[model samples]
Target: MPASRPNLRTIAEHLGLSVTTVSRALKDGPEVKPGTVAKVKAAAEQIGYQPDARGVMLRTGKTMQVCSILYSPEVGDYGDPGFLAQVESLAQGLEADRYSLVVLAQTSNKDPLEPVIRVHTQRMADAVVFSRTTSQDSRAKYCLQHDFPFVSFGRTELLTPHAFVDHDDEQAAYDAVKRLIADGHRKIGMIDPPENLTFFGYRKQGARRAMTEAGLDPESLIWMRSDVSVRAARDATTALFRTQRDATAIVCASQMTMIGALEALMELNMDTIRDGIGVVGFGGMPFRMLSKQKLAYYYQPQRHVGEVLARHLHDLMVGVPAQELQTLLPYRRIDDLAAFREGEDF
Candidate 1:
C-alpha cells in the first residue's frame, strides 16, 4: 500500500487523547473544552481527515440518497421538457431536505423497471422516484410489493396505497376543449398520445366530456393518436386534415404535437387556418415563441409539480402517512388572445 488515508483514530493516537474525546472535539461537542475542540479541528484540517460516508450510513441506516429513474425514449422521439423540469425541481426540493438526488437513465431499454430494479438491488440509493406511469406500472408495483419507500410522478391504477404527484390531465383537456367550443368551433379535432398511456385516457375522457357538454356529437369529432414525436404528430395532423375536411379546431397533447400540426398545415397550404382555427396545446407555452402560429395552450407548472413530488418522497421516507403523500397540481389555460400578449412565452 502506498500510504493509508488519515482517520479519527490516527488523529487521536497522534494527539495522545481518547477516541471519544477526539470525536467529541472534532464535532465541537459541548463536553469538549474549547481549546481542545480548536486543536482537533486544526489537526483534522492538517491531516485531510474526512468522515467516512459508508460508516455513517451503516451507523444511522440512512444513505441520504434519493434516486429517480428516467426512461430515454426511442431514437427520434422528442423528450418532454416538462418532465425534465420536474426532475430539476425534485432535485432542488430534495436538496432542502439534505438529500442528494441520483438520476439513473434507462436508454434503449424496453423494460421501464430495469434501472429502478438495478438501483434498488445494488443498494445504490435509499429511496426511489419514478415518472411516466402506465395503466399498470411495473416499477410502482415492484416498489409497492417490496414495501420500499418510493413516490411516482404520475398515478397508476394498481390499487396500491403508494404516494404520487400528478396533474389533472382530464381537467386540462376539458378546459382546452371548452375553450375551442367557446370560439364557436363546432367540428373540433384532437391530436393526442397513444391510448395505452393512463394520462392519454384521462385527456381523451376530458375531451369527450367537453364535446358532450357542448351538445356536440363526441363520436363525430375527429381524433388521432401520435407518439411523443413531432413527425408522428405531423403525420397524424395531415391524416386528420385529409380525412376530416370540416375540422375547425384541434386540441394537441403537447407543444411538439402543436408544432407538428403547424408543420402539416403549412405543407398543406393551410397556413391561413390559424386566423380561424381554434387550436389548443398542452404543456409549457415557451415553444410558442419558436413558432409563428398563435395557438391556445396550457401552462403546466412542471417545476412546482416536481418540487411537490420530491417533498412528498422525503415525507414518505420519513414515515409520513400514505394518504397524505398524494398531491394533484392544477394547470392554467392560455387562450389565443392571452398567448400573444404574454411578452415571454416561457
Candidate 2:
C-alpha cells in the first residue's frame, strides 16, 4: 500500500498536542501562544503536513492566496530591473508564509478598477496589492466598501485612510532639483510619469517648490508629460533642446527615461559635461552601469518596498487595522553617478 500523507493529526501526534490545538496553532489563533504557534508550524514542516485548502476555505473563508494588480508593461514598467526586483522580492516574502501570489495583468490603464473588482467578485484572493494609484482611486474605494483586505503600493487622495507603503517621491524630486540647481544648472526641465498617476503631480510639485525656494520662477520650470518609455523621453528631450536652448538640465521619471535623454544629447553631438547639462532621475543599483557625469540620482529600495508590501498585506489578512500600516519611505540618493568601467560586470 502507498504511504499515508502527513496531516494535522500527524503533526499533532508528533508534537504531543491535541488535533484541535494543532489546527488552532497552525491558523495562528489569537488564543494560542506565540511559542505554541511556532512549535506547531515547525512540527508541521518537519512532518511534511499539508492542509486541504478547499476545506480550510470552507471553514475559515480564507483563500491562502493574495492578488496583485499588474499594469501595462508599455506604461514605463516594461523591462524595468527595479520593478522586476520589487515584484520578485514581494513574491518570495509571501511564499515564505505559504501564501501564493496571483498577479492579475491588465491590458490597459483606461480601466484600473476592473482587475480589483474581478478579484473581489470571484473570491480569487484573500487580499490585493496594487501600484500606480491616482489622485482619487475608485479601486481603493471599492476595496474599502467591501472591507476586503488590501495594501496599495502607492497613495491616493481618498479621505478615508487605508494600508499603503509608498516612497516619498515628492521629497526625492525636490532633492534632485536642489542638487541640479546647486550644480549650477539654472534652466531645469523634466520628463514626467503619466499625468493620471498621483506621484506625477507630487514630483512636479516638488520640482516647482524647489525652484521657488531657490528664488527661481516655478512657472518657468519646463515640464513634459511622456508615456514612460526611452523613445518617448528621447523624443521629448530632442524637442526640449530644439526649443529651449538655454535649458541646462533634465530630471527624468526613471532610468529608462534618462537613457533616452542621454541618447538625444548623443545624437545632437552634445556631451553632458561639455554642454554644462545636468541629469537627475530615479532607479536602482542596476543603473550604475548607465550613470553619467557623476550626477545625483534617487534610488528606491525596491526589495524593501516589496517585502514591506507583502508583510502589510499579510497583516491586513490577519485583521490588523489598515490605518496603522501606512508607511512613507524616502528614496535614497546616490550623490555621484558613474558607469561601470573597464571589464566590470555590465
Candidate 3:
C-alpha cells in the first residue's frame, strides 16, 4: 500500500492547535504570532509534513507564482547573461512580495506560446511576463484576447492595450548618433537589428531623426540589419563598408553586434576610434577587457527594467487599475562626446 500523506488537520491535531491557526502559520500569515509560527513549523518538520500546493492554490484562487517566457529563435544556447540577470532580479522581487517565479524557455521546435497556455490553463501562476516583443506581436494580442494578466519587457506597435516596461530606444539611439556628430564624425553608419522588431525599428528611427536634425541627409547614413549572432554582424559590417561612402563613425544597436563590427574593423586593419572611424554602441559591454580608447558605449539598466515590470505586475495582480498602456522607463546615454574627445577614461 502507498504511504498516506500528512495534511493540515493531522498537523493541527498533533500540535493541539486549531486547523485554521496551522494553515495561517504555514502560509506565513501576519496574524500568526512568531512564537506560534515557530511551534507549528517545528511540529510540521517532525512529521515531515508538506503543504499540498494544488490544494492551497484552489482555495486561494492563486498559485502565488509567476512565470517568464523567453522566446529565443536560435537553438543550442538557452539564454543570455543579461536576460538571466533580469530574471534573477525579477525572481527576487517576487519572492519579497511572497510569490514564486518559474522560468520557461521557448525553442523554435516547440510552440512559442505553449508554456503560457499551459500555465494559464492549469492556473499554475498568478501572472506572466513576456519579453522581446515585436511589431504585430501575436503573443501580446493573444494574452489580451484571453484577458490573461501579463506584462511585456518590450513594447509592440500593435494597437492592443497592454502593460509593458522598455528602454527608450529611440531616444537612446538618437543620443548615440548625435554624440558621434558632435565628435566631428560626418559619415555615420548604423547597424540595426531586424526591422520586424518594434524595439529595433524605434532605435533605427532615432538614428535617422538625429541625422536629419544635424542637417545630414538621412539617405547618406549607411544602415544594415542582421541577427544577434557574431557571424551575421560580421557579414553586415563587411557589407556596410562596401558602400560608396564609408562611414567615419558607426552606431550599433546592441553590444553583440558591436563586437562583430569591431572584429571586422580589426580584420580590415582599420584602427577603431583612431583612423577617424569612431564607434558608438548601445547596451553594456565588457569594457574592462577591451581597449578603453576604442570603447564608448551606452549602459542599459536591465535589472531595473525587470524590477519595474515586476512591481507593475504585482499591482495589477492585487487589483490595482493600472494604465491600459504605459511607458515606465527612460534610457540615458552613458558616455558624453566631449568627454570622449578629450581622451578621458571613464
The per-model lDDT (C-alpha) reads 0.78, 0.83, 0.74
Task: Put down candidate 2 lDDT per residue, 26-98, tens digits, no spaces.
Answer: 8789999999999999888887888888987998788888888777674444335566677778999998678
Best by lDDT: 2
Q: What is the TM-score of each candidate against the true structure?
A: 0.81, 0.88, 0.81
Query: Candidate 2 overall Cα lDDT vs. reference?
Result: 0.83
Which of 2 and 3 is ahead in TM-score?
Answer: 2
**Candidate 3 lDDT, tens digit per residue, 1-346?**
9878988898999989999999999877999999999999888889988767677677878788898886664222322346666787788888666688887778657755677788788777888998767888877877888888898888887765678888888888888888888888878777876677788888878888988999988777777877765567777787777663556778777666677778887887777656777777765323333454465677665677678877888878777654643664665555543554565543
Which parts of model 2 have CA positions greater than 4 angstroms off? 1-5, 12-18, 28-40, 74-78, 290-292, 338-346
Clashing pairs in 3: none
Cα error, residue 39 of model 2, in Å, equals 5.5
TM-score: model 2 vs. ground truth: 0.88
Superposed by TM-score, candidate 2 places the C-alpha of residue 51 at a distance from the truth, in angstroms, of 2.2
**Best prediction by TM-score:** 2
Poorest 10 consecutive residues by lDDT, candidate 3: 73-82
